[model samples]
Target chain A: MTQTLDIERELCGHAAVGEAAVTVDGDRVVAFVVPAGGGLSLRELRAELGTEPDEFVVLTALPLAEDGQPDWAELSRSRKDLTRRRMPYTAPRTDTERYLAALWEDLIGVEDIGADDDFFTLGGHSLLAVRIRMRLQRDHGVTVAPEALFENSVLSEQAAVVDRTREA
Target chain B: MSQRTKWLLRDPSPEAEARLFCLPYSGVGASVFRRWPSHIGPLEVCPLQLPGRENRIGQPAYGDFPAFAADAADALADHLDRPYAVFGHCMGSILAHALVTELRSRDVRQPERLFVSSSRVPHWPPDRRYRMPAPGAVGVYHPSMTEEQLADEVSRVSRTVGGTDLHPDLLPLALRVLRSDLEMCFGYAPALAPTGCPISTIGWSDDADVPPAEMGVWQECGPVTHHVLPGDKLTFLEAPAELQEVVEKDFRG
Candidate 1:
């Protein structure tokens, strides 16, 4: 077994955790655990474990292999699909927000971005920011500076900047 | 026609209280600073238009940092009439350091401050090899990286800096510039040296390329002031308020 698997076994020893699986994903150590009591705060759980992981993923149950070990490949897919974004799905509330959200969804290739979801957190890189800038200018008549984009990277914050620019 | 105007992208105001000479990183020219406003506080932003990119596309690029610094010192000598500061990002940081060293060696007036962002100290001990951020299993650049990998890195960095990918027509030249620059960086592993100039090392909160903690090594470079601000490595392009405050504060009389 790997060192990560050992971590998984040790985490199972925690009373707050019903089940746990560990994996190394691209220089990040992610711990997928099922809370014994309906739920447990990540911070409180970390304090219980006595070590910090780069990412903490909560799951209902651990996928298992035929040999009864944790299914590594399935866990990988689950992590990719669900673990990256922590914010709940939130649709845009205002026209400016809706417009900014639309631009971000198209450029960032992610859907259902919440007001607080950071652009960089969604894998939004500089290239995408420039595309959003061009689209805003050409299609929406909104001229946004790259600095504006950098500072106001969240969906609602970006919308506010656009609204301010328009008002001015 | 003067050397000053030839080297600098624009003729900065002589009447200004001070000037900030900005240097571009590898594979690009002064145009990278096009987004920066003309003036911040008393310091005028004067980006150096190095040879081999943009308007100087026809000229051969410098193969070594010392040689580039020597030529720069000569060109910028007479222009240093007012108090000035030097700002460099990434490869430009090392170039900025080298330029300051060159100026000191020539007994020229030094910049009031040196602003280095997203760089490790120039003269790291012989063992620490610096590599480009690339994709895939190896996850870092090596001289053996394929042309495709280098091209991808160029595109990634360009995009990371808030620009789109390179057009097909520009890829060949871009790749050449990238290869040359990477070679220069990888070849550079000088002994740790202190700066005669005051230093301001800026670190970003979200920069994976060079983490903020890694920047503490810069304290050995000189009388140093360190800043940890919100944003990624490329966010410096935005001229964040905290960074501006640091620059203005450092250059303050």
Candidate 2:
């Protein structure tokens, strides 16, 4: 089996983790785990396993198919969904969102992105993020840092930043 | 005239005895090497401006290593009519190596030397720990961390090493370039084919990122000459006089 699977199995064996799934995101080994409840931290989990995951995401539950097998698509969707819900932002509704969404779709190649969709989770990287920023400057005369995407990846939040910049 | 094709070179030289094409590290443009003299003795400095950067801001970023190398080789073809060498620091090292292979595949003249700094073998899986949000912490691009946490990390880094402040206005653009370069670095897994060109690997005496000892692995690519210059990884940016002297000496030899 791949080392990622082995790590996932080990993580599941922990008393704090009821179930776990691990995958490679870029160079990072990301483990999405359903904890056994009652105060388990990533630091504590790493200490128990003696392995530091590139990213340790604590999930409410692992997505499973009707056959009781882990559903990979659902798991990916869950990760993105979890990210969107955590950030305090609404869906893209303004003209800036429409403009930014089109540019993001072109570079990230994703269709129908909501204002709540996370850019990084949608496979947005630094280069693509820069493309978005450049396009904003060229087309809209709005400029923000690349970290703005990292901070406010949601379309609406980013749009708000640009709107604030425009107003200022 | 052909300078349009080789837009990566901010300062193109047509009358120099030798040319040294310098590739910038992640998230930066050719402007990073703007401090370097246009001519070090007879060796003209030509800093490469990759796509999605300062001048090529509108061009699409190269998705992979081979494609980037191919584009660079094609753009640099006319300039290669004269003798030339290649230099890359950090992420630029991989570009330098891949570009050499691309040139060879096209049956073009090869560089006299391949100078790589603060980078590992092309095949090695990326060391994600290289870029930290804090001194010893990992910075995830995801929203797992609070926006405040992300801001703190980016601000801390922008204060040091990156050469400029994280001006809210330009930080995103700079980071976008960095991310694109990193994606290229992460996806790089070249075939185990060694080049015929000689290699020179530079390391900082106090660089914790790419230690001087780790530099020996570059020998697998070619006959390597390792040089551990004084100061840390950012030393090249802080005081380039020593680096310039070393390059001048090496090029002369």
- What is the TM-score of each predicted model, taking all chains together? 0.57, 0.56
The stretch of ten residues in a row with the least summed lDDT in candidate 1 chain B is B133-142
Prediction 2 TM-score vs. true: 0.56
On TM-score, the leading prediction is: 1
Give candidate 2 misplaced runs (Cα > 4 Å): A1-168, B1-3, B127-157, B161-164
Per-residue lDDT for B1-253 in model 2, tens only? 1214424443344556898998877666665664454555567777786777654555667879888888888788878887788988877888888888788788788888888887777866555324332345322232233545655555655566443446665555655555666666666666655767888889988776777888888898889888999876556753366787777777776
DockQ of each: 0.01, 0.02
Summarize candidate 1's per-residue lDDT along B1-253 as a digit string, tens digits.
2322447755556556888999877776676665554556688777887776544555677888888999999989877989999999878898899888888888777789899988788878423536545233111344667998777766776565544566444567667766787688777776666678889988888776677777778888888888889987678776766887888898894
Instruction: Report the poorest 10 consecutive residues by lDDT, candidate 1 chain A.
Output: A78-87
* Cα-based lDDT for every prediction: 0.71, 0.67
Q: Across residues A1-168, which tens digit of lDDT does each residue of candidate 1 receive? A: 376766777788877789998888889888888777543556555666655667766665676788998887767755654423325666788998887776665554354567766564454544456666777788778887665764466688888988888788
Q: What is the TM-score of chain B in candidate 2?
A: 0.86
